[model samples]
Target: MRPGDIKILLVDDEASILQFLELGLRNEGYQVMTASDGLTAVNLVREFHHHIAILDVMMPGMDGFEVCSMIKKMAHTSVIMLTARDEIDDRVKGLKLGADDYVVKPFSFQELLARIEARLRNQFPHLLNEVTIGPFRINDQRKEILFNDSMLSLSNTEYDLLRYLVINHGIVLSKSKILDEVWGYDFGGQENVVEVYVSTLRDKLEDDDHVLIRTIRGAGYRIDLP
Candidate 1:
């Protein structure tokens, strides 16, 4: 999707930072929405399906971590936490709660823009919009997956994971690599989440005697083309 086609939510208690990000992103042709606090951000998220959310971690009432968790559950939006706190624990905590990336405050607009672009590129790779592997057919543009022409209901995370696997079909992806690529720069290094999602996909995509995703022992997982 083009940058102009992407919708982004900018949340920060500080009006200056919020306006800065909104203006910068809009200059790049992106559709931008601004919120002064986490609670407002959450409400906006529920009202609109934002493609990316840049949240301030220090918001009053609902913090960024809390908002990130809520937004993750609501939509398949990529989240980046922007905060002045440089503590490692806070970064890890945000990632664990499903923030796709974290940025320290006092950051340059160029750097922030680069990070936003990187996140979008990673989440929505520029490749074939549609792909087919084994019995599954995937429409990356629409975020839809089908097994033998039968549609499979998937959450945002499930669709992202499945899309990544299908894009790299026949290649073994290590847990760490998958986490970095699919979950963004930080995921609290929760490798088990990958396992859980993979299990869920197999149960939905696999038949009695057939499995689309396979474990490679100590390595990670692969979705081999059948």
Candidate 2:
């Protein structure tokens, strides 16, 4: 999907950050949603499906990790955790808990935008090709994915991962392969990142009858074709 075609949910207790991000994203041509807390964010997820979410790790009610877990249980939503904590452990924990990416606080919005765009590009490279796999119909050119004739809202990372699996249906793609293919060389050997994305995708896509993507246990993942 095009960056402008993507819708993002921005969750933070800081009203200033929410306003800043919303304005920035909107100026970049993206549809943006804002929530001040985890409860509101979860409610928004249930109400309006968004392509991706930017969640603050520190909040009053529910923290980012809790919010991410909730989102993972819901749909194949891509989540990027924002935190002031720059510890490696914090980063690892977030990824292990199912976040697609991590951005440190005081980060450059330009970098965030770049990451979002890269994720989207990897997912919808064709951006205009109409293809179907099981109950899903994807129009790459149109930047749309439909499940049973209903539009499926996917985050930039989710869209890219799903599209990659669809394009390489029936092939076992190891975590390393997926990291390289989807995130490119700049991902710098982050294998855990691949696992997080795969887990998120499974949660979102497996709800339907056809299970197109499957885990290979100790190996990696594959797109199942019947």
Candidate 3:
């Protein structure tokens, strides 16, 4: 998906910041929603499904950390916490609380926009219908994977990795390629995450009935359909 195709929620008690982000992001072709406080942002999230959110740490009523926790609990929505605090503890706390990323206040709009784009790319990797490979089927739209007519439970990362492989069935994809395509640049060379999620997918998809994901020895992995 492109920058403009994503829907974003921007929350800040500061009217100026809210307006600035709304205008800048909208000009870049994104569907933007703005809330002046944390509670309103939570309500907006409940009312509509946003692709990503830019939240201010300081807000009236509720704080951004609380809102971030609420958002993370509901779905795999990407959130970037915005704060003027430069303290390392605050950043770590936000991360521990489930914020996808964090940005210091006085940050450049270009940087924030870049981070938002990267987050959206990671969250929604494809826009294709349910794809079938051998006995396995992946419903990208519903975020589900099915094997031999039985539904398989998969984590968010597992679903994305599986879908990426299935979409390119029969084609070998290197670890770097999988990381670049599935995790996005924001993942920062954490390629071991690919292996972890692949292991999870294997446990769910590989059994007596199906074995679609195949490792390529020293190369990478692929989805084999036969």
Candidate 4:
């Protein structure tokens, strides 16, 4: 699924935890909805079909375990239960109650992110393969790119740059920022490299007039359909 297309639900009684996870996941490009209680979480899930739900096992009035079962019956959304207790019974109970995974409290964001991706890979594998933008199709698994049904041969650097541009399509990307993201921090002081690669990519894309990837004069480069 596209970043904007992948919706995730976050439920935690702790406002701090909800804020932390919402901000972190949003930066990673997922659409996030946070609830401070189980009822609100259920209401959100019932309203929108979220791809995943991260629920705290303990809550007032209703708990994560109760929320998980309700979510499963209401929507196909996958559940990842969270808790401060690392008890086996808690894990098993959450799993048995329709939570796809269980995460102990104090877990690193990276670990939770890994589990979220694992669930996506299993349940929504198509999201991993093809991400289409305008006339471009990027297949990260095969390391291949297709434009207008024509597969383009590209070096690793070129491929990364193109994918980055396609991902953030229509946004002006400054040379310094491109250098940092596409070429790494070690590529600092090499702004000219961005020009060279853009030139090559334009040529390969048959965009001789720079219509596909336009130079924003004094600003930077932006890709827009001609």
Tens digit per residue, CA lDDT, model 4, 69-158: 899999877889899999998998888888888888889999998788767754664567676667988788888899999999999999
**lDDT-superior candidate, 2 or 3:** 3
lDDT tens per residue, model 2, 1-226? 3456677899999999999999999998888989999999998997777877899999997999999999888876778899998989988888888888888889999989866654454443443246666667877666678767888678887887777777666778888888887788678666888777777776776634335667788888887765
Scored by CA lDDT, what does every candidate get? 0.83, 0.79, 0.80, 0.87
Off by over 4 Å in 4: 130-226
Error of 1 at 110 (Å): 1.0
TM-scores for all candidates: the values are 0.59, 0.58, 0.58, 0.58
Clashes of 4: 1
Residue 4 displacement (Å), model 2: 4.0
Point out the worst 10-residue segment of candidate 2 by lDDT. 119-128
* Model 4 whole-model lDDT (C-alpha atoms): 0.87
Which candidate number has the best TM-score?
A: 1
lDDT, candidate 3, 1-226, per-residue tens: 4555668899999999889999998899888889998888888887778888889998878999999999889766899999999989989889999988888989999999767755654466563344555677777678898888999888787777877787677789999999988888667867777787888777776633335677787889978877
- Residue 30 accuracy (lDDT) in model 3: 86
Model 4 residue 80 lDDT score = 91
* Ranking 1 against 4 by TM-score, winner: 1
lDDT for 170 (candidate 2):
70
**For model 3, where is the 10-residue window of minimal lDDT?**
121-130
Measured by lDDT, the strongest candidate is 4
Better of 2 and 4 by lDDT: 4
